[model samples]
Target: MSTVATAFADSSIMLRRNVKHTLRNPTTMFNAVLFPIVIMLMFVKVFGGAFSVGEHYIDYATPGLLVMAVSYGLGATATAVNDDMTKGIINRFKTMDVSRGAMLTGHVVVTTVRCLVACAAIVGVAFAMGFDPEASALDWLGVLGLFVLLAVGASWLTVAMGLAAKTTESAGLATVPLIMLPFLSSAFVPADTMGAGVKQFAEYQPFTPIIETLRGLLAGHVSQGDAIAAVAWCVGFAVLGYVWALSTFKKRA
Candidate 1:
C-alpha cells in the first residue's frame, strides 16, 4: 500500500479499537449521551415556562441544547485521548510502526460520531417534548452541515486538549470551558435579554452566532450574516485545533 493508503488502513484499525473501548466503557456513553438527555428534560419540563422565548419554549431551546449537547459530550474525547497517552498505548503504537496520525484521527472521528449521536438524541427528546421546527428541506440540510462542522471542529480542539494534558483528570477538566461556553451564549435565552456586559459578550461569542444560525435555520428566517459567521467560526476552530493537535502530538506522543 502507498503511504497514504497505509495511513488510512491504520487509522481504521485505531477507530475500531476506540469504538470497542467506548462500548465497553458505559461511563463514556453516559457522559456523551444520557447526561444531555437528562438536561434537555429538565430544561423543557422544569424551566421551559419561565424563560419563554416567542415560540413554544422547546422550539426556542432545542437549537441551544443541541449545541450544548455537542459541547458537553467532548469531555469524554479529551479524557480518552489522555488515557492513550498516559497508559503506554502510544509506546506500543510506536514500536508497531503505526501511522502516528492514525491514533489522533481515531479519537477525532469517534468524538465526532459521538457528538452526532448525542445531537440526534437531543432532537428526539425535543420532538417528544413538542419541540417543533418550521425548517424546510434545505434548512434541515444546513443544520446537518453545521452540526458536522461544529462536531469536527470541537473534536479536534478536544483532541488537542487531550494531547496537552499531563493526566486524564486534567484532560477532562480542560474541557470544562467547552461545556460551560454554551451557557454563556444564546442557547437557553436570547443574547438581547442578558444584561449589558453579558449581552455584548453573548452577541459576539462564537457559540452565539452558531446558535443563532441554527435558530434561524429552524425558524425559516436565518440571517445571512449569522450563517457566515457561524461557518467561519467552525472553520477557524477546525484549523486551530488541527494545528495544535498535530504539533502537540508530535512533541508529546
Candidate 2:
C-alpha cells in the first residue's frame, strides 16, 4: 500500500479502538445526548416566553441549540487525548509502528461523529417541541455540511488541547471555552440584546458568524457574508488544530 493508504488503514484501526471504548463506557454518549435535550426543553418551555424573536421561539432557538450541542461533549475529547498521553498509550502505539497521524485522526473522527449524533438528537427533540424550520432539502444539506465542518474544526482543536495539557483534569478545564463560547455568542439571545461590552464581543466573536449562518440556513435566508465568515473560521480552526496537534504529538508522543 502507498503511504497515504497505510495511514488511512492505521486510522481505521484506531477509530475502531476508540469506538469500542465509547461503547463500553456509554456515559460519554449519554451526557452528550441527554444534556442537550434537557437544555432544549428548558429553553423552549421555561424561557421561551422571555425571548421575542418574532417567530416560534423553538424555531429561533433550535439553530443556536445545535451549535451549542457541538460544544457539549468535547470536554471528553480533550480528556481522552490527555489520558492517552499521560497513560503512555501513545508509546505503545509507537512501539507498534502505528502512524502518529492515525492516532490523532482516530480521536478527531470519533469526536466529530459523536457531535453529529448529539446534534441529530437535539434536532429530533426540537421538532417534537414544535421547532419548525423553513429549510429546503438543499438548505438542509447546507446545515449538515456546515455542521460537519464546525465539528471537525472543534474536534481537532480539542485534540490539540488534550495533547497540550499536563493532566486530564487540566485538559478538561481547557475545553471550557468550547462549551461556553456559544452562550456568549448569538446562541441564546440576539447580540444586540446583550449589554454594551458583551454585545460588541458577541457580534464580533467567531461563534456568532457561525451561529448566524446556521440560523439563516435553517430559516432559508442565509446571508452570504455570514456563510463566508463561518467557513473561513472553521477552516482556520481546522488548520490551526491540525498543526498544533501534530507538532505536540511529535514532542510529547
Candidate 3:
C-alpha cells in the first residue's frame, strides 16, 4: 500500500483504540457535557428572569451553552493524549512500524466525535426544556459547519497541550483555559455589557467570535462581518494547532 493508504489504516486503528477507551470511561462524557447543562439549568431556573436578548432566555443562551460544552471536550482530549504519552503507549508505537502522526490524528478525530455527541445531548435537553432555536434546516447546516471548524481547531490545540505536558495532572491544568474561556467571553452575556477591559477582551477573544457566529446563525441575524471573523479565528487556530501538535509529537516520539 502507498504511504497515504498506510497512514489512513494506522489512523483507523488508533481511532478505534481511543474510541473504546472513551466508551469504557463514561466519566469522560460526564465531564465534557455535565457542567454546561448544570449552568444552563441554573441560568434558566434561577436567573432566567434577569436576562433578556430580544428572545426567550433559553433561546438566546442555548448557542453559547452548546459552544461551551463542545469546547470543554478538549480537556478530556488533552488528558487522553497525555495518558498515551506518559503511559509508554506512544513509545511502543514508535518502536513499531505504525504511522507517527496517526496517534494524534485518531485522538483528534475521536475528540471531535465526542464534542459533537455532547452538542447533540445538550441540544436535545435544551429542546426538552423548551429551548427552541426556531432555526431552519440550512441554518442548522451552517451551525454544523461552524462546529466542524471549531472541533478541528480545539482538538488540535488539545493535542498540542497533551504533547507539552509533563504529567496528566499538568495536562489537565494546561487546558483549564479552554474550560474557563467561555465565562470570560460573550457566551453567557453580551460583551458590550461587561466592564470596559473585560468587554474589550471578550470582544476580541477567540470564543467571542465563534459564539457570536453561532448565535447569529441560530437566531437568523448573522452578519457577514461576524461570520468572517469566526472563520478567520477557526483557520488561525487550526493552522497554529496543527503545526504545534505535529512538531511536538515528532519531538516527543
Candidate 4:
C-alpha cells in the first residue's frame, strides 16, 4: 500500500478502537457533556442577572460552555493515552509498520468526534433554555470550524501531557489549566468588569480571544482580530505540543 493509504488505514483502526472504548465507558461523555450543561445552567440561573454583561445571560454563556466542553474532552484524550501507555499499547504500536502520525491522528479524530457531540448537546440545552442563535448558518459553520481547530490543537497538548504524566491521575489532573482558563478569561463577564490586574491579563489571554471570536461568530458580528489571534494560538500550541511529544516519545522509546 502507499504511505498515505497505510497511514489512513492505521488511523482508521485506531479511531474505531478509541470510539469503541469511549462508548464502553460512557463516563467520558457524562463529564464532557452533562457536567458543562449543568454548570452553565447553574451559573445562568444564579448569577446571570447579577452580572448583566448582556441582555440574554444564557446567550452570553453558550459559547463559553461550548469551549469548555471542547476543553473537557482533552482530559479524556489524556486519560486514554495514559491508560494505553500503562498497558504497553504504545510499545505494541511502535513495533507495527504503522506511520508514526497514525497514533496521534487516531486520538485527535476520536477527540474531535467527542467534542462535536458535546458541542451539539450544549447547543441543544442552550436552545431549550431559550438561548437562540442570532447568527446566520454560515457564521455558525465558521464557529464550528474554529472549534474543531481548537479541539485538534488541544488534543495535541493533551497528548504531550499524557506522555509526560507519571500516572493516570496526573494525566487527568494535568488538564486543570484548560478547565480553569475560561473562568479566568472573559467567559463569565467583560474584562472591564474585572479588577485592574485581572482585566489586563484577561484582555491579552488566549482564551479571551477564543471566547470573543466564538461570541462574535455566534452573534453574527465581525471579529477578524479575535479570530486571527485564536487561530494563531491554536496553531502555535499544536506545533509546540507535537514537537514536545515526539521528542519525549523518542527518548522514552
Q: What are the C-alpha RMSDs, in order, of all predicted structures?
A: 1.0, 0.9, 1.3, 1.3
Which runs of model 2 end up more than 4 angstroms from their true locations? none
lDDT of each: 0.91, 0.91, 0.86, 0.85
The weakest ten consecutive residues by lDDT in model 1 span 47-56
Write the residue-wise lDDT of candidate 2 on 156-229 in tens digits.
Answer: 99999999999999999999998989989888789988998999999988999999999999999999999999
- Model 3 Cα lDDT, one tens digit per residue, 219-243: 8778888899989988887888899
TM-score of each predicted structure versus truth: 0.97, 0.98, 0.96, 0.95
**By lDDT, highest first, what's the ranking?**
1, 2, 3, 4
lDDT for each residue of candidate 4 in 1-253, tens digit (9 for 90 to 100): 8888998999999999999988888889788778888888888888887897856888888888888888877888898888877778888888886677777778878988988898999899889889977899999889988899888888888888887888899999999999888898888898999998999999998888888899999899948999999999989778877887788666664
lDDT of 1 by residue, 1-253 (tens): 8999999999999999989988898998998888988888888889888995888999988898889878988888999999999998998999999999899999989888888898899998889888789999999999999999999999999999999999999999999998998999998988889999999988988999999999999999999999999999999989999999999988887
Query: What lDDT does model 3 reach?
Result: 0.86
Work out candidate 2's RMSD over C-alphas: 0.9
- What TM-score does model 3 achieve against the real structure? 0.96
**Which has the higher TM-score value, candidate number 2 or candidate number 3?**
2
